[model samples]
Target: MNPFDRRPTYFFGVYHWRERLRRIGASLSLFGAAVVVGRRGGRLRRLLAALVGVTALVRAGTTARRLLSPVPWALDRPKYDALASLLPLGDVDRALDVGCGSGRSLVGLAPHLPSSTHVVGLDVFDDRVILGNGPQLARRNGARAGIDVSPAAGDASRLPFSDDAFDVVTACRVAHDVPETRRDALFDELRRVCAEDGTVGLLELPITPEGVSDHEAYWRRCLGDAGLSVERVATVERPGFSDEPYVAIAATPTA
Candidate 1:
């Protein structure tokens, strides 16, 4: 793929630079160990060296495959698509995507929205967490995706928009990233900017530690805490592309 192919690049801190370096270091160490053991000149040592060398190769290959795969970002297309479908975009005049990294979520939603809709994206654009993340990248990606997006820099906990400013609000895989201390502020902001009767869609990894009941309860509590009523919670699965299951939570500001 072209380095600058106008596609949204949202590799957000999953494999941190430190983590990558550590993996590389381990692989190199294993290779060194194999070399050292192979020179012992014994049948058992030779067998051990072969196994160790193979293990090192497998580890290296696994890391390389993960780096090459379009995971943790590009693979979320199906989730975004499901979210766009669940939202009330038919009559929406404006939409706001909170934490819109590189505008990939917007690209998924743009196709479902009216051409006249004004789509705005807001994010802090911390390049440390997400490589090459910024308003410029979002604009370029939006342009390439054939959608006009207004990308802005701002904090999610304290959005730079007035109350009831947007007809639809969306936060894709963003709620979990907020600091625990600011979770209330972040959700409140999401609800505050949304117009009356407007929808706030959240595509999140399910809290499925215990079971399905607990999972649903977790979301209900989350939305309730934010003063939003849960409208629907549905699963969206994309076989072969994504291994993790995602849930689309649709909510509206409570009366």
Candidate 2:
């Protein structure tokens, strides 16, 4: 049976269901507004309205897709291993997962880290945040090892942590999903949460070529400019998309 079928978890489940439904309603309202705007507007206004309509459609579709799919859009399928491979330190004091969908990667790698380490998973999706069993599983397994998984909702671009709070901060398959305009800010937030000498593992889809060369070059340039030293990079063949490979970059924020 579903764990959320119980009392505490059920409360959060109700909240999530309501939130998801509200978002769907809001997205539909936005689409209707765009259509109405287009009917009464000039060419330029119609163009702008069309853009808004498209954006709303995409947003609504993305939401519905996640609701229907087993895995969320951000970390669907073999992407689970994508983040797990990024941890070089193998569990330190505390680790944070940004855009952590369903916390599958956290639970998978929890045992790899020391029992004393704390693993926190963050995601903005209401459903995933409510239902992610990865954190609970990790908590259960790590009880003997003294590890705990705390899941929370957070924005990728605006982290609520002080500078250098986490020993390790990981953003798995998240950069591309974010708007390019906000990617820099999101990146900065990742750096902010990371301990000064700590590490940030970014596992992203390679927009460049498939090999490690392109992967290394892209992250090297972007992360280097952001004051991160590229410690290591490896080419990984993600299971579902074997033809479309991925790269895992491990970097440290400079002083």
Give one digit per residue, the lDDT tens place, for model 2 in 1-255.
996664211111222444566777799899999999999999999999999999998888877665544333222334445555666556488888887655545644554677677778776754543444343433443343344777666788998778888998888767777776787788788888899879988877776433545654776677777778888776678667776677778889987
lDDT of 2 at 151: 69
- Model 2 residue 147 CA deviation in Å: 4.6
Supply the global lDDT for candidate 2.
0.68
What ranges in model 2 sit over 4 Å off? 1-86, 128-147, 207-216
Model 1, span 103-207: residue lDDT tens = 778777777888788889998987665556788877766665666889989999999999999999999878778876887898899999999889999887654
Top candidate on TM-score is 1
Q: Give the clashing residue pairs of candidate 2, or none.
A: none
Question: Which pairs of residues have clashing backbones in candidate 1?
Answer: none
Structural RMSD, model 1: 4.4
